[model samples]
Target: MRYLSVLLLSLLPLLAQAVEVGERLAPWTLLDQFDQAYSLDDQTRTLLVARGMDGAKLVKEALQDRPKGYLEARHTVFVADIQRMPALIAKMFAIPAMRDYNYRVLLDRDARVATRYAGAEDKVLWLQLDNGRLVAQQEYATAAALREALEKAPH
Candidate 1:
């Protein structure tokens, strides 16, 4: 399958999902909703991927309240280019399920960190934070559909 190879190749460099969770997430700066810069690194205490969907919101809410339950809920990663995902990102964020959880839409900015973190084009990837360390990684596509699939996965 030529397409499959192309797709896998596209995801190669973005696959560095190791030790990023509790391993002091490398400092990354992104502009949040208020048009302000947000940075997360070793000094940070919390990092949330404010997903923009009711279903995802629910998961985030659960994680915030019943962190154990929420973390226990098996979830995977979804990735997409910022250009093709504004609506989906908005929809994913507007859900009451994630009322308190905050997230920044991963953008295709010109920076080495994101470039090394994400990969060619935009990709969806998941990280499993175990006791503050990233122990797992998963990537499906550049959209929410893949995240849905990961939610149902056996993990």
Candidate 2:
């Protein structure tokens, strides 16, 4: 029992260090607004995470005028954590509204994936990855700034 306890204690630090740069992110799959499953893989170059409604609005505004495949062309994925929203609201309004979006919105229903990365609640967290390994991270609080960054990012 003592050995087991010691082993578990040692693993705590590893669990706490979620989504760190210079490390590979564990692969995950989540359903999008259209109920299509998307998975993190080597081809995913950028991950845009929004933990709250404001952050999600930033992403929405940034992509409002863009074409349907804009993010996909850049090998980018946008994840929105909707776990805090009430189930009734999500089903009756949120998810339904999301279906009209031009770009894909990966829904983090339980926040399991979004919680792994650390960032401000109102800012969009941008994770730059190379073949599944984290290379850089940035946070955008403005839709214009996020739009500019996305435009400047390589395809």
Candidate 3:
């Protein structure tokens, strides 16, 4: 038991080091509101992650009035972690409402992917990548700030 405890303790640091810069992110695929599969690849320049409904709302407001494919054109992808939501609620209310949005929101239903990165629970995490390698990270707590950054981001 002591050996096992020691082994587990040693592994804690590795598990805690989530989403560091200068590291290549493993590729992942998730389905969007439209049930379209999107994958993280070399072409993805920016990844936007929302850990909960609040963060998702911020992204929604920020993208309001934008044309379709606005994020794709800028090589950006938005992911929303919805693992905590009940499946029945998601089907009856949440997902249907999301279909009206102009942007694609990749659903992290199980949180297996979103939990790999570290960020504030109520803030949107913006990860800048270069050919699948992480370069920088930023967190936005407001829609206006996120909108401004998105507008000025390079295509």
Best candidate according to lDDT: 2
In TM-score terms, candidate 2 sits at: 0.89
Instruction: Locate the minimum summed-lDDT window of 10 residues in model 1.
Output: 75-84
**Candidate 3 error regions (>4 Å):** 1-16
Candidate 1 vs 3: which has more TM-score? 3
Give a tens-digit lDDT track for model 2, residues 52-109.
9999999999998799899999999999999999999999999999999999999999
- Per-residue lDDT for 138 in model 1? 52
* Cα-based lDDT at residue 81, candidate 2: 95
Rank candidates by lDDT, best first: 2, 3, 1
Cα RMSD for candidates in order: 9.6, 5.2, 3.8
- Write model 3 residue lDDT over 33-81, tens digit each, in one string: 9899988999999999999889998999999899999999999999999
What local distance difference test score does each model get? 0.39, 0.93, 0.93
lDDT of 1: 0.39
Candidate 1 versus the native: TM-score? 0.37
* RMSD (Cα, Å) of model 1: 9.6
Of the pair 1 and 2, which is ahead by TM-score?
A: 2
Candidate 1's residue-wise lDDT over 1-155, tens digit each? 99999999988755756345345445556653334454443332222232223323333333333333232244322111233235565456532322343433333223334443432232334544443355555543333554354345454
The runs of at least 3 residues in candidate 1 whose Cα sits more than 4 Å from the true structure, single-residue gaps closed, are 1-23, 41-103, 106-108, 118-122, 130-132, 142-145, 149-155
